[model samples]
Target: MPFFVYGTLRPGEHNHDRFVRGRDVRAQPAFLHGGALYDGPGHPFATDGDGTVRGALLTAAPAEYPGLLVALDRLETYLGPGDPRNLYERVVRPVEVPGSGTVRAWVYLAAPAVTRTLRANGPRIPGGDWLSHRPPRTDRLLPPPGPRTP
Candidate 1:
């Protein structure tokens, strides 16, 4: 099975080694349209139509598909289809792989309600690329108040 992975699941990201490294037979750059990506805490969440998301198309051996799916589900905190607690839903969508044309692949996306909330509150990742994003500066305005006086 082929899975479309963005955010931490991309090669070199934190979760890639643990969840996809050796388990997958192949991975290549791919693009999916009709959705938007957002900054959600340590990772990114995908929302419905009208934008593009750049990611990798990871393909696993048929024999490894089941196990890989289970592992990914655990990492994503996905319960079953329509489960209220699911952090991301694994859905099949068309992804355009360079040189390979369009292929159907499994992708994780947020629920409709959650997508709305994220849009309202989260930072949208421009260009749909996560690796290029830099976190906002966090420097303090002044020194630490020089320890408290007695």
Candidate 2:
């Protein structure tokens, strides 16, 4: 599955090699529309917008998700179903990749408030390039989205 990653977790950034693994992994510059980029304490998050936000389109083997999850957060540190960690929350958001049809790939988006707060305090990593190198922590973490229920 292809995962959209932005922040300090993108390839060749401060945190890429620790998370991205496997011979089947591939990455390319991609984007997501309808969002605004905001800086955080140690990362950045896109809020509601109409223009495309810069990021990466990660093509990985079906088995690579698990490894990526581990690098995202810590097991048993938050919850189950995936791993229990406080790195990112998984969701299926619409992404607009140039020359490619709209596709819904799994993306780990940072919480808006936390990401924004981080940005106000210090310098941001700038797009997905800086994201590839930061390690995730247990601070104010989240999980993948679940089905909407009444």
Candidate 3:
């Protein structure tokens, strides 16, 4: 099964390699329609809205899916279906895969109350792309563009 991840769970983000790498058989850039993304405490959360969420559709081996889902559920702080303490709810949603068209994939979404609170004050990630909204790393060693003219 494929899971759509839009936040830190996406590649190169904080939790990707730790949680998703190796577990996933393949990953393709994809988009979730009708959603808005918000910057949470240390990650991002998505809610149903009138926008598109940029993400990746990751295919996990059938045998790995169950365990992966369990680990992800724990990582996302989801106690279980309808648990009040749940920060996210796993649901099946349609993701638009570039070359493969639409596919149903599991996605984690913030609870409605959580979504409301986050949206009321938290910064909305422009274009629903977490990777795009992140600030550039100050620790990277890339040289400054062109030599200084001074």
TM-score of each: 0.85, 0.61, 0.87
Better of 1 and 3 by TM-score: 3
Q: Give a tens-digit lDDT track for model 1, residues 1-150.
A: 698998888887768877777774588999999989898887889877689999999899998899989999889888888888888888999999999999999999986667778978988999998878745323333566567878
Positional deviation of 78 in candidate 2, in angstroms?
A: 6.8
Candidate 1 lowest-lDDT run of ten: 134-143
Ranking of predictions according to TM-score: 3, 1, 2
**Residue 136 lDDT in candidate 3:** 56
Which stretches of candidate 1 lie above 4 Å from their native place?
Answer: 134-150
lDDT of 1: 0.84
What is the alpha-carbon lDDT of model 2 when measured against the actual structure? 0.59
Better of 1 and 2 by lDDT: 1
Per-residue alpha-carbon lDDT of candidate 2 for residues 1-150, written as tens digits (9 for 90 to 100):
577777655675555655674446888778777655655556666544544567888877777767765655442122433443434456678776778867787666544444455456634443433444355554326665788779
Q: What lDDT is reached at residue 122 by model 2? A: 39
Q: How many residue pairs clash in each candidate?
A: 1, 20, 0
The order by descending lDDT is 3, 1, 2
Model 2: per-residue Cα lDDT at residue 7? 64
